[model samples]
Target chain A: MNNTDIKRITPKNITDKEFFYGHKACAGCGGSIAVRLALKVLGERTFAVLPAGCMSAVGFIFPQMAFVNNAIISTFPGSASMASGVSVGARALGLKDYKTVVFAGDGGTADIGLQALSGAIDRNEDIIYVCYDNEAYMNTGIQKSGLTPFGTKTTTTPAGKNIHGAQSFKKNMFEIMAAHEIAYAATASIGYPQDYIDKINRAKHTKGTSFIHVYASCPTGWGIPTETTVQIAKEAVDSGLFYLAEYQNRKFKLNKNPKSFFSAKDYLLKQARFKHLTDDDINIIEQQRDEKWEYMREHWK
Target chain B: MSNKKLFISGDEAVAIGTKLSRPNVISAYPITPQTVTVERLSEMVESGELKAEYMHVESEHSAMSAAMGVSAVGARAFTATSSQGLLYMAEGLHYASGGRYPIVMMNANRSLALPWSIYGDQRDSLSLLDSGWIQVYVEDAQEALDMIIQAYKIAENKDVLTPFMINLDGFVLTHTYELVEIPEQEKVDEFLPPFQTPNKMSFEEPKNLAFSTTPADNLEYKYQQNRAMFNSINVINDVDKEFGDKFERYYGGMVQEYRCDDAEVVMLTLGSITGTVRMIVDKLRDEGKKVGLLKIRYMRPFPEKEIIKLAKNVKAIGVVEKDISFGYEGTVFTNVNSALSKIDNAPLSLNFLCGMGGRDVSKSDIYNMFISLFNAVKGEKQKRVQFINMGVETDE
Candidate 1:
């Protein structure tokens, strides 16, 4: 659905209710922003699941829980299965209306949780799985994750002369989910709050498993200024380093395809994790971005 | 439907019992011996005989995780697994128990893999005894079915909101056919009303559940979990008694004593091996031997009290189990010793490490075990732990 045709809920129209707040999230935490906005769109009647990751760590500190909706912390690798259970449990219990949402991190989703998430999608579980990707295992002090971009340094994937940074590219999570032929799958960035909210709204209304991978920047882990988390995340999308896309009904749709991209070199230089990269490394990263966008431009609608 | 006798395998009995429990969610992956239970449940779901969400999860880890989800929403959940699959869900096992999710699982007792054998053994469940689950072993297909029904009532009790696992010997009980009197659905409904608990995420309260706690507050949660699991011993007795009153079958709470009245040498057994041990005991009794049998039903809220009471009268107790603690003794032997140690004058206990990796505990083997025990009572000096039916020479 296009913007004009769809009756969208903006900040002005969004509920004045605050469901997620007063947590230990970093000042410029994009993951927290994503969770707050998604919870707003899904509302208080939602059964939210936070796996053993960043959001769960910050939100569920025993007596000081931040979620206003009924929520539970799932095992690190069991977000999908647990979310599926919550949805079916409520349905089987004859609860007519409710949403089941999962807020997982990069490692929790792309690495450990992939199998369970795929299972849920295969079963066509009526739940929304929002993966707030911070590129690394931010909760555990910035260890490299499956979604960590190449040339980025983390505790696990350290930068040095022998190996500059992570030796692998970010996994194509959005497409991997699309390959399941899920009811809906989307890639979003915290930089673009409106787009992220729109995708969550689609997930809220979906009758089957819906996946939304929101690129949330980790200020503490990435060594970026707290206030620049959203800007940096948005710039990566604008620079074609990360693209916004959706998969529905066996079709891939590109949400944002800049005719003239922002500089990937500049985007990388802003983050401390990528500061160690040389000009040659930047060239390789930019080349990878160009190749990915070329294919997305040629293939996706 | 009225209660009717039907000859079926232990796995089929489990499926029937699960159906009667009326769980809202069942998530499991296919594993040997345990596969039949899920297959039958699937058929039931497809045929509209059971109305439940049968989630075909990709792994046992997810299977248990989903069951926790089912429980966290205050819905009844069921799952089945065997051997490696049980180990795969080990982390979730502790999580389910600690979360106070009253999920019921039927585990086919199979050996853990190294050389890899999909046969009857108590090692798998024994290995995970400390995972905070209330574990029970059945002697036959009938008890397997009956326990599957009672497991729900005991687990869902407000004072005992912990996960329960009903174990059946792989290939032996899981595959063996027996004439089982399936409880009528209406009667089972009366026995197990509905799973109700305060330990769930609710819309009315909007509570966050299963969160991390500071070390200051952590032990109290565990202390409470400990209380619930131990308190379940009474619930087990109460539930089994009520089941007997309604269904005409009673599993003697945590431990069942057969002919242990004034006996000097009593043999303890678990799962399907108990029947063979009972037969051996009966044969010795026919020959004028003062021998008896003790069957361990629940292993977690262990039959410590009953064991201590029984040991007070017995001269010696022999434990026949299929598990080893490696360089120590049988796991059950260790647990039984711990209980008997609590008393001033504990009886002489021997551990018989028999039937590993699904090997049959033949009646001959069980008879030999009793002979060994009877000999032990007669001041025969042998090792504390002996491997029965050993084919190879041991240095000892």
Candidate 2:
């Protein structure tokens, strides 16, 4: 009864009410765009939870709250748990036609908040949990996080003469949610607004727990031109570094299975964080991406 | 009709009280001494005897975090844990209180880890007095049950929206069985009306809660939070009086005094040890020792007025608590000293570190506490924090 019944929406016909606006966020902020768009799809009759990350830090300043709809900041590791609580609390109150959603950063979702997210999914709580992946702990000045990709230079994983940026690759968070046999799971990019907005719509129709891992870019943290955030985000998806996929009914499906991927090398060099990647490092990243797509194409429907 | 009286442990009493209050959500995580409370609650939920969203969370951190979530929607929430679990959710404790969520939690007070014992001690909750929750220690099963109902009423008061923590000494009160009178559901419903607060998220009026604070207004928010705690002092006493009118049982506001008036030597105690201290006072009074007891029910609005009033006529006051500030003195002792410092000639006060890690605070140790205070006035010098009834010797 609490699931969103909103009809199919496109960017041209999206609501201009601006549920989330103002306060402070960097120019061309991908996370903010994802948050604002998700709120638009879910509508004002929704309870949103944000953790102690970039989105919350930027949007929820004292004396100035950016969200017009109801939203609260949760503990760094307890975002999913607190969201689940809001979901149950509404149901207990005999509330009708309201969705509970969470917007957390990569570090908040995959690192400190992983256990809580798993528990909420295990309980099948009626919540649409969105993990906006900017690849590093940007709010804390760009520290390395579990979702930080390989060959990425963060404050914690600085590239040096001996050791490279990050020794290992990013954790497979989307697949991990799929492994839980979650009610609904998907991966999207801020670059593809229609596809990402539709994914939020798909989550609204689901009866139980749903997870969406959206690849949101960080201009300041990634050392990219602010205006190029959407372009780089779309390029990452086009380069096969990030794939759009969905899982439901215990089955995985790729939303965009590219026939021929774009140049992964150009995508990496576009950002300053990855500009430090050597020719050999670029080769390794491309190989890793190709290997992942090979498995995804073979296994995913 | 009056509800039936049953012989039950303090934990069971809490479960009954929780069910009667009809909380909308209960976040449960299991740990020793607190296991029975959650188990009973789970049974009630499973049998459909209690209507609640029973969330068996992964850890204590989520246990508290979830309760705060329930409270954010203006729904009643319940959770329980002991020593290490309490320490684990230490961050959530402050989060809930600062958020002004009137969630009622039962903390089965136990010793913290190091030596790693699962026994009763005040160290767990006492160590976190600054966590901003209103802390109350129950002396017996009846108080445990009664406080569960009253905690919600006091905490949910418009003036005091801080979270409330009800502490029952591990194994002592939590596991020990005693006869408790259960209140009728209809009567309790009348006493505690359905929750209504403008603080919650409602379609009628949307609000942003638990937002970030900057230096420009951070000081004012903290000052307001402190003022709310101060407001709870009267609310605590007033609720007790109202509960007495409705249920015929009353907990003496924050500090319960037993024969402390016109006494020469007084002993201050917290949690379950208050019962034994009362008996010790009774035993000494027969011998004309002029000893008395002060049971500190609430530790956070620190009972400053009660402590100062009880100390005025006493020759010397001794605080027997299960907590230690490690190098300095007992945590409760530190609070008592702070209260006593306000008056001139505050008398010689001593801190007796007894019952550490669930070790027994024998009747003899209590008797000695009274004698030590009496002798201190007689010019027999002693350490401020006396390590009493110890198996190991300490150089003095």
Candidate 3:
């Protein structure tokens, strides 16, 4: 048995009915599930600061509060700033037992919210900022966001015969957070529930700024079958397209290492977004993913 | 307890004041004009005189961020910058204020933006006038040092949960040397109490800070922040008097009006350039010019009541601005206009854009600017604004 396969002990036997019932999450929206699992480990002592995005629009608002603990909402990109304010206020109030979780979407975290997030991390504020990476602005009609992978087709990045969807690679926010030499930063996917929980748990107990980038499949944005959300997430990690790793202040630790190399085709073929891509396109993506995976495997332990 | 009356630059006096303030965290990046203050603080830290966490941040943004962090965790935080640096840290400035951290910062007033040059100006602070910070401009090094010590009390005052900024001119006040009394540490201790964060993480009792704003009443939260800013005006005045009584140094109740009693022509100015204008006002008064000076020490929380009251007494006012409003006219002049409009006997204020991009404003230039105001009062001068020593010959 490996570290990845180790059974994580459940704190208490709880009913499975807690998984947001009759929710409005678009088909395969793994963001809701990710938030649910994140909060399960975070418990009730956490306060989630939500910036305007998929997470805020979907998870919050109205009679439907996806969060159980205290939640604070800010503008489209002011989550980090508000979180900083809350951190100061909480510290001032001597309420250090409670954890401040900053949950934002890709556009909110990677683009507009970048300055405040970077500033917060650099300052090492005792806050957990989780970016639900859905590749695009799924809340705003599937618009191409900063986290949109190089070849994904979206409303903004419409693919054609000559033109591809996005012209750039996915922005590696995990790497950026790692560069700050923060106490803890990890990349996780909803597909790997135990691994995701382990990373969240690690971040919860640590002091200073901790970041977790979770791969949340957007059914509407990615144009995938809603029920296959978990499958897609699992495939991405199993194929080494999205590796699970952790960085504890400059020290790298790979949590899950795929036993053998699985081509990107095994991952992309299942998704409708990549269905239009020819073998040549698939081969190119596979090469890029393998190159990145090899680099991480070689340098990161 | 050395009774040392050293003739030091305003910049150096600020350094002494910062050292005396005993901040646990001092982080800043060097910018034109205000570089000396940080340089001196760095020296003090290096020499073991001040046992402080001195972080050489990459940018003003980082400096403010680091300061906010230190301040968040119950550290007495301080930082200094000017112009571009001020704007660079604009986002952090608001956060610090909202976080209610009594973070004291020194902003060396310099002209901001295009056709940009490193020089004394009020545009920097004026641009961030609504950032929820208590801003105080000092005409000399003495006040720069005195105001900084007082800022902590005013900012940390239980009612006023906000950050404070003491702005002085780059070269005009920061670089220029003057005789300043270095008050005893005991006196400072008595006047400004030891730095204590009201809300911060404590090992004895852990706390969570940086929570999200409650979505239910976020508007009320913003309103509360606004109210806190407005409340600082009175708090600032009260502390100014208390500090003055103890240290014999005060900014005269937040807004210092110099020689403006029963005068028709009032010349308005901020920062060290006010000293030159004050001299010009005295010269004009001796020549029976009926001119006086209204030196604006506090820019944020505005001092609107005092400005409107002062404007009601004066007939024609000349606003000497070291910074321009860009595309319009003067930054201070624009604010002064809004304040006076609320009064019964509002003065005819003229915006004189001068000393921009570090242009030296001499005594003669101030006198010339006042002379133009005199002509305007007499109906002899057609132009409302007379640019003194400004490079131009353009037809309006």
- Using DockQ, give the best candidate's number: 1
Would you list the C-alpha lDDT of every candidate in the order shown?
0.91, 0.91, 0.77
Return the number of clashes found in candidate 3. Answer: 18
Q: Residue B147 error for model 3, in Å? A: 1.5
lDDT tens per residue, model 1, A49-104: 98999899999887899999999999889999999999988889999789999999
Sort all candidates by lDDT, best to worst. Answer: 2, 1, 3
Residue-level lDDT of model 1, residues B89-139, one tens digit each, is: 999999999999999999999988897998878899999999999999998
Candidate 2 TM-score to native: 0.98
Error (Å) of candidate 3 at residue B25 is 3.9
Candidate 2 vs candidate 3: the TM-score winner is 2
Cα lDDT of model 2 by residue, B49-155, tens digit: 99998998999999988998899998889998999999999999999989999999999999999999999888899889998999999999999999999999999
> TM-score for chain A of every candidate model?
0.98, 0.97, 0.91
Q: TM-score for each prediction?
A: 0.98, 0.98, 0.82
| DockQ scores of all models, one per candidate | 0.87, 0.82, 0.14
lDDT of 3 by residue, B1-396 (tens): 546798999889899998888777777889988888999999998998987756665567767765666566566778999999999889878877776878999998887777677877777988898888998888888888888888888888778868999998878888888989898887887777766766654444434343344578567767888888888988888888888788776677757888888788988878777777777778878888678888887878887888888877888888887766557777778888888878776767777777777777788777777777777777775566556575778787
Please report how far candidate 2 places residue B277 from its true position, in Å: 0.9
